[model samples]
Each structure stands twice: as structure tokens, then as C-alpha cells.
Target: MNDVIIRTEGLQKHYVLGAETVRAVRGVDLTIHSGEFVAIMGPSGSGKSTFMNMIGCLDTPTAGKYWLDGQLVSTLSEDELARVRNQAIGFVFQTFNLLPRATALHNVELPLIYAGVGGKERRERATEKLRLVGLADRMDHKPPEMSGGQRQRVAVARALVNEPALLLADEPTGNLDSTTSEEIMVQLRALNEAGQTIVIVTHERDIAEVARRQVHLRDGLIERDFLNSTVETTV
Candidate 1:
């Protein structure tokens, strides 16, 4: 761990559900340094999802401050948040989120397209990331043409195309079989070991075990945050 890539102080998010106000996250203070691999875990209604949204910049918090890669992001405007997300953070979802008609290379180039990178550069970058994820041979294949794990590998390549400061994955292996799930986790572990700062929101204990640290959220607060005892990594 080097620089502080993620920091949240008294982070909170509340939702208005007609007559009821739901406090999805309440006063969570957390910090994840550069090169750290962390997992956020909890059962249903435990606030892990809400907290992940805040971290990913997909949703703004109702209160508190958050800094991503040392930039205060909690108060960023929607457009500004969008820019920051595109440049600084990369996201992976369980659904794969690929365009069924697009080739893996083109799908990986989507973020660069949003960022206005040149087509040539975008292709080059996407190509490099696809190779990084061991999907070089499948770059020309579309989502519908690939297997579940391969499609998710394409998703991973897409997430890495931007060279983001943080890689955030939410239930990344939820749709995969147990074997495929392990494969994704192994990929994530390899990425982290190679020094890509990573964070994942997963409920699977085996998946969570792959991370260097685990934070368990419950009833809108962090119930536990600690380094993996078996890994021997510093806090």
C-alpha cells in the first residue's frame, strides 16, 4: 500500500421511499491504499451495494466526504463525477454488460470512445488490455459468441482499457459457475499482485477470501474491517 486511493469519512446514503426514509449506509469511515485488494461483503439489506455505488461514483452519497485517488469526489457535480469515473475508476459488473453485437475489442474500446480517444489509439489500447486479460485470441468475438467466463474476461479487459486508478467490480462472478467464479477470482488476484488497486463487492466467502482485506457491512454500518489473517499484509 502506498498512496491512499480511496478514503471515505462518515459516508452515508439515505433513500426516500415514499413515506419511509431508508438509511442504506450510515457513517462508514474507510480507507484503501494504492495496490490494496479489498472486498466489501454482507448479506441482503446490509448496505454493501449502496456503499459500493458511492465508491464507484454511480450514486452520490446523502452526506459525508469521499476521496478517490486523493480527489474529493463526494461533492462533485454529476457531470464532473461522470468525468472522474471515466478517467479514474473502472467498473465491472456481474451481468458482463457487453454489447451482444460488438466484438470484444470494440466493447473494450467503449470507454476510450467516451473519453474521445482516437480510433487508432483506442484500438491499440483495447487490444493491449484484451491481451492483458488473456483474451487476445477472442478479441474478434462478440458477446453472444463467447462462453460465460470469456465474456466476463472481455468485461475485465474493458474495465482495464482506461488504465484507471482503481478497478471496482460488483458481483463480478455472480453469473458464473463455481469453476468459472474461481477463474475470475484468480484473474483478479493476479491483477492485484501485479499492483492494480482493486475493490470488489461480493457475498461469496470464497471470493472474499481472495482479497487482502475484508470489510463486512451490516445494518448500514461496517461490522468488521481487517486484513486477511493468512495473507500477512500490512493494514
Candidate 2:
């Protein structure tokens, strides 16, 4: 009723491994509205990763319904799903998935290129996004030449370049130190404040606390869904 951006009803994912059918997500029901910042927290082997993949449109659920921006994702074909993924979602991974050989600007411009954006406009838009993330000066630098924080910043810039409706980050801070992780969190918080819907999957409590709402997963089921006490005022 609240203008849901993502809704899942009885979502389930199962994998068959050597005669064993393992249920990764067991009947998950969730609704996240626009402008919400949510965190999925769980220990290793939990279904959080599977859930994130499903939500991010990277993988399809074995069963159940997934409505993204009011459209039933499970009904879409592979090509249709790819289009929806490009138009509606942006993803940030734990490993800064930048093209090591490409410059920061180039990495950020990849999405636009895939969408067939022209050269001039792509460069201009990429520059603006990188600047928004405080990486304007590093646009020409390649990932290997930059620090971990800088690489992550570039990744964030890339995630935002398309102006997607949803940003899905998987353990975004897993590779960074505490200080650097906080810095990236600050950037993500700012994006959420700017009305970007975000769903982050993380195992670290401190990182999860940065979000306004936290959903805990255990043994392929949601154990808790609650609001954070220390609301992100800075965002």
C-alpha cells in the first residue's frame, strides 16, 4: 500500500547438489518501499546471499513471486530480466568489481555504454557521478593505481551512473578496513538520503546498523526485522 518498490511473496530458492536438494530461501515475504535503506544480515551459509541474488535480479527464485517496481519479475524472460536489471537496479559487490585495466571514468561509464549512450553524454554524466562521490579528481586513474577506498568510490559512482531505482550492495565493506568502510557507508547514506532505494547484504553488525532497517536471516529464514535505534541522521 505504501508504494512498494520491491515485494516478495513466499519466495523460495532451492539448489540440487549431488542428490541433495538444499533450500536456500524458504518462503520469504518482504516489501520495501521507495527511499528505504534496508540491510540483510546473516552469518555464513545463511540464505542471505541467495536472497540478495534473487532481489538483485542476478538469479531467479525456484518458486514464488517477486514484484519489482510493481512488475512480476518471475514472469519475465531472460532478455526481459536483463533489461529490467539494467533499467531498475544497480549493484555494488564486496570486491570492487571495477575493470582493473580501465580508468575510473571508463569503469563508471560501462553501464551507459551498454545502454548505448553516446560518447559525449556518457563522459559528461560519468564525470558528474564521480564528482558526486568525491572522485572527480581521480577519474583518469585506473583501479590498480588507486586506494581501496578510491576503488570502492568508483564502484559507487558506477552503481549510481544509471540513476537506477534500486541499489543492491553485497557486503560492500567486506574488503575495506573499518575507517574506509565507514567512509563508504557515509557515501551510501547520502545516496539514500537523495531518495535512492538501497538494500545491502552484510554480516557485520556495525555495518548493518548504519541502515535504517535491518532484516536478519538464519538457516534460510528471516529471524528478525527491526528498525535501527541509531538512525542515520547524517543522511
TM-score of each: 0.97, 0.96
Clashes of 2: 0
Residue clash pairs of candidate 1: none
RMSD of 2: 1.5
Put down candidate 2 lDDT per residue, 1-235, tens digits, no spaces.
Answer: 2579999999999999999999999989999999999999999888999999899888999999999998999768888888888888988999999999999999999999988899999999999999999999999999999999999999999999999889999999999998899899999998998889999999998888889999999988889999898785442
Q: Which stretches of candidate 1 lie over 4 Å from their true place?
A: 232-235
What TM-score would you give candidate 1 relative to the actual structure? 0.97
Q: Positional deviation of 217 in candidate 1, in angstroms?
A: 0.2
Full-model lDDT for every candidate: 0.92, 0.92
Write model 1 residue lDDT over 211-233, tens digit each, in one string: 99999999999999998878622
Give the runs in model 2 whose Cα sits over 4 Å from its true position.
232-235
